[model samples]
Target: MFKPSAEQIIKVMQGKGYSVYDTPAVDWNLNIVGIRANDPEPGTFNDTLAVFQRLQGAWNICYYQITTDPSLHYLTHPVNSSGTAILKEGQYKGAYQLDIHNRGLDSGHLALCQRLKPVTVYRDSNRDNKLNLLEGKTQTGMFNINIHRTCEDYIQRQRFSAGCQVFAEQRQFAEFIRACQASEKAFGNKFTYTLLHERDFQ
Candidate 1:
């Protein structure tokens, strides 16, 4: 498997020229992309790239833990008996909300919803009990594609996610929230999030 360093991920995000989350008094666009490595572990990836860019060419890159089960099959359906889509890989775009009411918790994290073409992984019980992945034309539109923090202090703790991109490190996720909040204050209340597979880069 090809493991990407922080610098490599930034290079890829920078090359894409997507909007960035920067400071105030400047044209800042919040672009957060989660790049999944080719790790075969379930509900976790060996490397995750979280990069935020500023319109003035400034950027911040943070390393976070994503599910190792980086497969479409496990993304929409429950992997094993976890009942979570620990790893969902694809390119997705939707409205980013800075303050959201999720699970009766209101935090600094963000939610990506509203006209979202998100991915879905569900088990086709009638088809011999097999897991299936659907998106785009075959998708029926999914909600709650949130980018939030997790309870895991380390990467190996088996953090749980229901197909959402979770950050195992609380500190890192806090910093991310701060950046997005700053961007929101300067810009509008909506942002853009994109999740790309390792193959999609380069």
Candidate 2:
């Protein structure tokens, strides 16, 4: 029910000094934005991942899914133990491109790869399993936080997202991948991702 219109999103983007590709020539202004909910709980899919685009002077919501925080599960039992990666909110231009996930494996699938560029992320080193985003070190590097799908069935836990923008459902992710593939064919492999907090909806 927290779905936002394209105009609302554009306004928020402009307010934050972020770019909005509204040119008619630009068929797909792909945007991957994360909406952090109020009273967010760790290890739960309380967040939203929205995929929208501007095509032919109109806006379209390609897909949206209930997604978990990038550093939710890792807060308690971090993969690094020293620091948990939490993606900073803002627009990242050309931070991702199309590529295969888990390549050369049986579970390989089409996904947005972030190997082409670097992104800013907060390294939450508390390891206390709490949602304190700003109380961490800010670092910018190529932290392969690719956008990919989770399990084929119901997702009971936040096991897939280890600082990556992940999808909760497989069918929706497939649809999103198709849209990305179409966008890739129309434009190119480059993609811009924007992460937004729920408060930005105002």
**Best-fitting candidate, scored by TM-score:** 2
- Which candidate leads in lDDT? 2
Question: Model 1, 137-158: lDDT tens per residue?
Answer: 1322454546766564323433
- Kindly provide the TM-score of model 1 when superposed on the true structure, using C-alpha atoms: 0.62
Q: Candidate 2, which ten residues in sequence have the lowest lDDT sum?
A: 152-161
**lDDT of each residue in 92-172, candidate 2, tens digit only:** 888899998768977667898787878987777776767557844777888877888877332455456667777767787
- Please estimate how well model 2 matches the true structure, expressed as its whole-model Cα lDDT: 0.74
Candidate 2 residue spans exceeding 4 A from truth: 71-73, 104-106, 152-154
Worst 10 residues of 1 by lDDT: 123-132
Quote each prediction's TM-score.
0.62, 0.87
Backbone N/Cα/C clashes per model: 15, 0
